[model samples]
Target: LRILCNYAFNYLNIHKIYCKTDNQYAARLYEKVGFSHEGTLHEHAFHYGKYIDKFVYGLLSRDYLKK
Candidate 1:
């Protein structure tokens, strides 16, 4: 996933990428690839008839370059 993210960032000339996912598994994967928790949108998402918080994670090119 890190490799894919790197490729995407490079391909798009993006300096940063932010991700929002409710899947805990994906969230953990994102963190493993260097995404840090930026903030959360409280009750910003609706799932299973209830509102759930959405976690915002981001990674910058500089941060990835440091790795």
Candidate 2:
């Protein structure tokens, strides 16, 4: 994932990236990839017959470049 992010930020020249994921597993992965939690939308998504919170994660190209 880190390699992929590097390629996207470098070769692709993307300045910012955003993602929405379930509250559980995505936290660690996002942190590992240097993405910060921007915010959460309460009950913004529905899955398995229930509403779930969606977390917003983002990373900036400049910040990734410094690593």
Candidate 3:
């Protein structure tokens, strides 16, 4: 995750990276890797037999460089 962020910010020159997930574990992993919780979309996606909330996380180039 760190390597990917480094490449995106340094080589690709991306201003920001966004990730969306419905799993708590993934959300925690993103946070541990420097992503900030931006927002949530309630009942955004359907999985299995029910709708679930979607979590949005973001990391900016400047923020990524600070790590």
Q: Count the backbone clashes (under 3 Å) in each candidate.
A: 0, 0, 0
Measured against the true structure, the TM-scores of the candidates, in listed sequence, are 0.86, 0.91, 0.94
Better of 2 and 3 by lDDT: 3
Q: Where is model 1 more than 4 Å wrong at Cα?
A: none
Q: What is residue 53's positional error in candidate 3, in angstroms?
A: 0.4
Model 1 residue 40 distance off true place after TM-score fit, in angstroms: 1.1
Candidate 1 local Cα displacement, residue 36, angstroms: 0.4
Mind sharing the TM-score for model 1? 0.86
lDDT string, candidate 1, 1-67, tens digits: 8777778677877799899987789889999999998988899988999999988999998898788
lDDT for model 3 comes to 0.95
**After superposing candidate 2, which stretches have Cα over 4 Å from the reference?**
none
lDDT of 2 by residue, 1-47 (tens): 79888889999999998898885677889988799999999999889
Candidate 3 Cα errors over 4 Å, as ranges: none
Local distance difference test, per candidate?
0.87, 0.89, 0.95
Give the C-alpha miss distance for residue 22 in model 2, angstroms.
Answer: 0.7
Across residues 1-67, which tens digit of lDDT does each residue of candidate 3 receive?
8889989999999999999999899999999999999999999998999999999999999998986
Clashing pairs in 3: none
Local error of candidate 1 at residue 17 (angstroms): 0.7
Q: How much lDDT does candidate 1 score?
A: 0.87
How many angstroms is residue 26 displaced in model 2 relative to the true structure, after the best TM-score fit? 2.0
Using lDDT as the measure, the top candidate is: 3
